[model samples]
Target: MDDKNSQTQTQINLVVAEPVIDIPTLTHRGPVKQRSPPPILARFHAGYFRISLSLCGQAFLWKTLGKPANDSFVIRRLLRLLPSTAFLLLWSIALFILMTLSLLYLLRCFFHFRMVKGEFLHHVGVNYLFAPWISWLLLLESAPFVSPKSVPYLVLWWAIVIPVVALDVKIYGQWFIKGKRFLSMVANPTSQLSVIGNLVGAKAAAEMGWKESALCMFSIGMAHYLVLFVTLYQRFSGRERIPATLRPVFFLFFATPSMASLAWESISGNFDTPSKMFFFLSLFMFMSLVIFFFF
Candidate 1:
């Protein structure tokens, strides 16, 4: 019995020592490399189309209004001359810069969030869409010879504003309603200081009225930066956990128009009747969609 057991152990050892070889290596011809999917040139193409569409839209509006082009014609012409390749290059550069800034901002927000407790900064990074839009609006409004009717333009502006405010109320509920954090913060000494300063600047500009476009300009600038910071913070902190149903609203407010405005602002030198009208119109459309759908 002992010899039989020894023989079985020896057989097992022999089998184990048979020198196994990897089948893949034995059968291999050359390197087995993983194939990656094709790069998304489609999105790039889409971006170019969108940019072209915006330019065409601007041109159409200007032609419709019979407005004469000023020195801004140079910038507009340059943009028009941008070939598809150049457009792609410009977009790539801009996207890279934006992405880098977004990452940095997100890191800062994360650091801040860790340092603080339940004091979550609401939608910080996610709000960056406002910057380019504000910039575009400023450029449009500052055009050399373009003066759009203020009342009609303001109506368009409220279209976006009212809906956005309403959406904020709906999504945030009591926070916006009771004016808890938002109102409190707005009323805070520090916040109020800034607000008052802005209002004063705006009022002074209103008084001077011509070159004193300072207040609205300042407001636009401040809003742009604020949106950028809020967007970055929200992105990093993952606070904008908006459900799928609410995603369209979120995109409307923060995504589509934001990108469109950014592109328009980046290339356009002068914002005139066309740009302002578009800005207000876009805002109105977004807000209207939100109000109609959500509210």
Candidate 2:
């Protein structure tokens, strides 16, 4: 029995020492390399929400900061030279991109539920979702100029705003009601922008003559902004752990007040005392930001 076992082991060792050649059943081609899908077809992640930066620029330029420049003689003359249809076509392209991204984002969230849920638990990730609603409102603001008296704009506004408001309530409930670490979470500037998104919606609602709804949204947004402001200030004053990559979001401190002023002025139909106060507050915040960063 021992001799038989030794013989079997020696045979196995001989087999192992011999290199077996893998004969190809068919002709071999080069290695299969995976190519990434095009942007349109690619699976979007939560990070795609940063496209809202474009929406912010659009809102700031056409809606608030550069409204005067947009109406200037040079631009007006240039616009006059182009066909009126060009404006609508351009806006249509932008709207299409926004809708496509939003649909893709939803699909990603659906397919990757656990991953997306984890992202939502993070303060920045939850705030990033607000980008879609912000872009929707920004696009809606251009509807009047693109096609005056268009019913589609009103329809789209209701479709997006109602759901966004519902989402805002749900998200804030989770963050404020359920979250025990809400104060520590406020070190992230992106979280405050979620509150600003309500103001964006309020501006659009006011434009559509939904005064009561607009007032409600604006009030809720301001109330939350105040709380978030204090919480973030606390984080800034302490030895909080903030990632260097996200430090630029601190500019949101100024942007929130600036946008609040714009929304207030829009809803009130006048640049009254409160609007002026908000604007000055934004100005002070801007100065503070500059001083903090520069020095």
Candidate 3:
């Protein structure tokens, strides 16, 4: 009986020792493998690439709108005038070239399986492209020899064109992507209002009212961020349906005010005069109809 008990204890000890040896052998067979995370530099490059693509799209719109000014003859006629015109022409050319390069880079990145960050880039590109137009119009107004009266018309025309092009792009992204509806893309109250706020703020700044402009821009930026969060929520929750009444409200409260402000600023020279009033009114009505029916 004593010998049997001793044998049983020995067997139990061996069983425990076997598992300990087996565990060490298994662990030593190979080093634990770990997945490396994507590098920060790669993320930065992806962001830049996306922004460049959006800018390229915006630049394409501008290029299609009008031919580049033929200033070579004007340059020959006046050497002094040549310097400024040459500078403007060269700057514009550089912008076009950079836009193209960025677009090609974006395509390469996409095909190579690099991350493509599109949303912020799209917004930034649109704003950057529009900046030149705004600057040119402002320069024309502020030049000692230039007339301020001409500013309004140019501003009006540009305001209409930029938004229309953006809207078209938004529509294309929606319909073709097929993951989301068209109105869902643009009908975010926060985003729409934020854009309006930015425009108003910029306009107010030009008039030497910085405080109001700052406040407006800040409010708009906040609203835009909120809208982005809301969009994510809707996407996750699968609640894509916006009320029927809200559709018209978006047209009225958001689209109309934007168009009206642009029109008003564009026609600021003759606000009190009756002659251009009808023209401006017609312009507003036309844009309103387009936004309501189409967008």
Candidate 4:
């Protein structure tokens, strides 16, 4: 029995060490000796959630940060002179349309429970499930019509943040309870998204003046992030598991700290010392990545 368990562990290590990902065959199956693209990719999976997520984040930046960033003399003198809620509204409408279409596809049409089950079990794909909710929360935070302390706002926050907290339990619970064939073996940069999603939720909670809730969410995200950060930093597992095309996602390294700074700033009611440290760290990481690409 011990030998059998040892052999199973060895096979998992071999599968993870490979550079190529057989998305179709990521499920548990007997040795099939061949691989092909999963038809499911064309159908729909949580993996594609990242597409609209990227656009939603960009819109969030424009609406939530870019418009108000007129402290610079040039921006204040010229751009601030031109009032254009029109562009922001246009972007918001487009983002809403995209989110509607994407959610309709993911949830309305048959809702592939089997495929979702597979995604939950698959390490890389599972992490992406967080992207959709993260996108929605960012859009909500950026929505001009929503009053942060209003009843509807509170309801929507619960509707979105509850799922994130639930997923944290299921995923992080597994990380805590399972020592074999899990977390340490499969932790990847994508896992960082799960952390980011929680931080995003924390920021939203803080916006609504829910300080206790914000700290609770923030602690969960930062705790797991620290563990995963060290794991990926040391290349403890799943480092080579990513493909070259996905290397750009390493940018998320700095993004995590950037998001942390914003969340902490909101929680503390000031961009205080800890927030400054986080911001500086994010800047340093951004420059490090820039230099990395330069050479």
Against the reference, the lDDT scores of all candidates come to 0.37, 0.70, 0.40, 0.78
lDDT string for model 2 (1-295, tens) is: 9998887874334334532233224336745444333444234665565565575445344434324343466655565566647656656666777877877877666556666777767656667777777777777776536432367767877887786777677667776666544456544788776777888888877877788988999999998888878877774444345578778878889888887887888899888999999999999999999999998
Clashing residue pairs in candidate 3 are 152-266
Q: Weakest 10 consecutive residues, lDDT, candidate 2?
A: 18-27
Model 3 misplaced stretches (Cα beyond 4 Å): 1-117, 120-167, 172-179, 193-237, 240-259, 268-295
Cα RMSD, each candidate = 18.6, 8.8, 17.8, 11.3
What's model 4's TM-score?
A: 0.78
lDDT of 3: 0.40
Q: Report the C-alpha lDDT of model 3 over 55-113, residue by residue, as the tens digit.
A: 43343323322223445544344444344554455446545555554555455455433
Q: Which stretches of candidate 4 lie over 4 Å from their true place?
A: 1-41, 66-82, 104-111, 237-240
TM-score each candidate: 0.25, 0.72, 0.26, 0.78
Best of the candidates, TM-score: 4
User: If the candidates were sorted by their TM-score against the true structure, best first, what order would they fall in?
Assistant: 4, 2, 3, 1
The runs of at least 3 residues in candidate 1 whose Cα sits more than 4 Å from the true structure, single-residue gaps closed, are 1-75, 105-112, 115-119, 122-175, 182-295
Q: Lowest-scoring 10 consecutive residues by lDDT in candidate 4?
A: 18-27
Clashes of 3: 1
lDDT of 4: 0.78
Evaluate model 2: give its lDDT.
0.70
lDDT for residue 105 in candidate 1, whole number 0-100: 36
